[model samples]
Target: MTRYEFVARAHAEGYSPPKEVTFAPSTRSEPHTHDQLSFVYVVAGTFILNTDRAAPAYQPGETCLLDANVAHAEEAGPQGATILVARKSGRVAETG
Candidate 1:
């Protein structure tokens, strides 16, 4: 497995605020960290979310929550995949 290099800029769709990213077939991303808490929703194809502790496969419609500054990586399935990534910076509201 090779380390994936992440681009500095966020990929997005026209007129849309959220970042949209696409992976090439058999693509593997290098471990990296995000500036803020984020969520990645898998729109098509499959991928594996790799972290320091675990690696889990994510399919279409599956969503993953990533904490701010957490180091992680991603591996795309053979057909590649499209994902929507949104970010936020704040504390989550607690339910009592």
Candidate 2:
């Protein structure tokens, strides 16, 4: 989806306004947990997301939603990655 669409959807889902984040080439983050839900939209390059269940590569136009307190790590691809992130506190709503 386009950035505009992503922002609109995120907001509709109760996410806060997005903030732009850029990761350096090949950068890696230690495993961590967030107090709030995280909504990430890959804007450029690639983002490799690691979690207990899986590790997936997210390319531009892809999105990832992480639940509150979930353990996760991230790595930037060789070309690095730029993403838009939004957050929401409390529990996320259930979907059918």
Candidate 3:
């Protein structure tokens, strides 16, 4: 049988995996690193993203590309944020 999904777990697929991550009204994750990564669609309410200071503050529909090892932090804790991130397991070749 064929199934349809609006959201899936990241563990389902190693690469280009789909996951539904939910955040509370005020939640922020610890700063982390990914050698090569890209964030696809982010359905957010209200949040602030931190990057190398070059990237502008993200808002709804505002997409940004983050380089590897770039110190970054985000605070959606104030009002809460939900983002669906997608990344490649290996070094990033290209992102658009």
Each prediction's RMSD to truth? 9.0, 2.0, 6.2
Instruction: Estimate, for each residue in 1-96, the C-alpha lDDT of model 2 and write its tens digit.
Output: 999999999999888999999999999899999999899999999999899999999999999888889899988999999999999986566565
Give the lDDT of residue 65 in candidate 1. Answer: 69
lDDT of 3 at 92: 43
Better lDDT candidate (2, 3): 2
Any runs in candidate 2 off by more than 4 Å, and if so which? Answer: 91-96
The digit string of per-residue lDDT tens for model 1 on 6-95 reads: 111223311124567899999999899877767677778897888988988888767776777778988899999888776766323424
TM, every model: 0.74, 0.90, 0.56
Best of the two (1, 3) by TM-score: 1
lDDT, candidate 1, equals 0.69
**Which segments of model 1 are wrong by more than 4 Å?**
1-16, 91-96
The candidate, 1 or 2, that scores higher on lDDT is: 2
Clashes of each: 2, 0, 1
**TM-score, structure 3 vs. true:** 0.56
Task: Judging by lDDT, tell me the better candidate of 1 and 3.
Answer: 1
Ranking by TM-score: 2, 1, 3
Pick the lDDT winner: 2
**lDDT scores for all predictions?**
0.69, 0.92, 0.53
Tens digits of per-residue lDDT for model 3, 1-96: 001221243335343664445567666567776675554344666555667564244555444445566667656655566666666554444455
Among all windows of 10 consecutive residues in model 3, the one with the lowest summed lDDT is: 1-10
Instruction: Give the higher-TM-score candidate: 1 or 2.
Output: 2
